[model samples]
Target: MTAPSKQTVCIVDDDAQVRRFLAEVLASVGLVAEQHASGEDFMRRWQPGKAACVLLDIRMPRISGPEVHDWLRDREPGLPVIFLTGHADVTTAVRAMRLGAFDFIEKPFNVQQLIERVNQAVRLATDKSAAGSGNDGWQRALTRREREVLRGIIDGKRSKLIAAELGISERTVESHRASIMAKAGASNAAQLAAMAAGQPPLD
Candidate 1:
């Protein structure tokens, strides 16, 4: 089989050791790593259509990871972002995911798992680029109610909880979930979530 073309994974963190360690790990798996010492440095160098995915540290010296993510959302909506966070930042990381982050990994991460998520993010970015405009078509096809259900799903809410919050029945929530998956051409929640990374922020 032919080898895949190397893709760059941008590592934006204040810690030099973390960046170097992550770069080495990514390199071991045939991926190239681009290191940035801080979020400010990353923002200065970043442009649209660069890097397969970003490994962003949640807490940086300046222009924190969430801030960078917000900037990316406007300019490079299709680019995948995987937050690197500590245990205390898990809540913030989950909020980021709800707001369209590709994924988040806690510090002292598992090397193999991190590699797997990065590869998935890269594939997602490639697919989005190939699809030309990401999930806009299907996202546009969704009704306002469906969008609400999708937001709940992206927020990691269970059907019963979503139903309660939305003042709908559990069955209705499930139906909306099914319709969402169908519209997104996703077979499961994870696939739907991956595609949701490209979806616009729900009102």
Candidate 2:
């Protein structure tokens, strides 16, 4: 869980007391806390690889929490966010999940529960970092041309359409696809699509 010493956290919420309360609790655990009053403030100061997690309020006066998440999605911070929702919903929660929030904590969460969930989220983020290092070799296994061909295959393109785009023969496209499927351990278009999207092998 990053040894607790090296991790920094950000508590982003509009409420002054929310920020202070979070900051104190985090300090008690030997982690760093940098508080911000709004999503924009957090985004302005945020560095990509620095923080471990964000305790963000889902509602704020300007630059709401969900927008802040969308901004960070491309940044790909090691930071996993546990959202604070004053008015939680099935649809809003689902959107947050789809956008890759670590967890959704309803308002008035217990101190121990928040701490436990944060610890779990940090562990997950660290595991993802560890696993990525081992897959560096596969990162370059496919050439640019091969990737484009794979995309076509996943899109259910006929060999002729792919070939015409790449200025290659349909037979050549087929041959390249065969090689791709074998290397990716995929049996069909759906499998190929999953691989292309960087997903794990389907059961």
Reference-based TM-score of each model: 0.67, 0.64
Score candidate 1 by TM-score against the native: 0.67
Give stretches of model 2 more than 4 Å off. Answer: 1-6, 88-90, 136-203
In model 2, residue pairs whose N, Cα or C atoms come closer than 3 Å (at least 3 residues apart or on different chains), thus clashing, are none
Q: Each prediction's Cα RMSD?
A: 8.4, 12.4
Model 1: residue 17 alpha-carbon error in angstroms: 0.6
**Cα lDDT for residue 196, candidate 1:** 84
Give candidate 1's error at residue 12 in angstroms.
0.2
Q: Candidate 2, residue 87: CA error in Å?
A: 3.5
Q: What does candidate 2's lDDT look like per residue over 54-94, in tens digits?
A: 88888888788888877876565335677887655435744
Colliding residue pairs in candidate 1: none
Q: For residues 1-203, what per-residue lDDT tens digits would candidate 1 score against the true structure?
A: 21243288999999999999999999998888999998888888986666888999999875899999888766765566889999999989877765567778999989999999898777655554454445466676567998998888888889899999999998677756754554454555677777888566455
After best superposition, candidate 2 residue 136: deviation in angstroms? 8.0
| lDDT for model 2 | 0.67
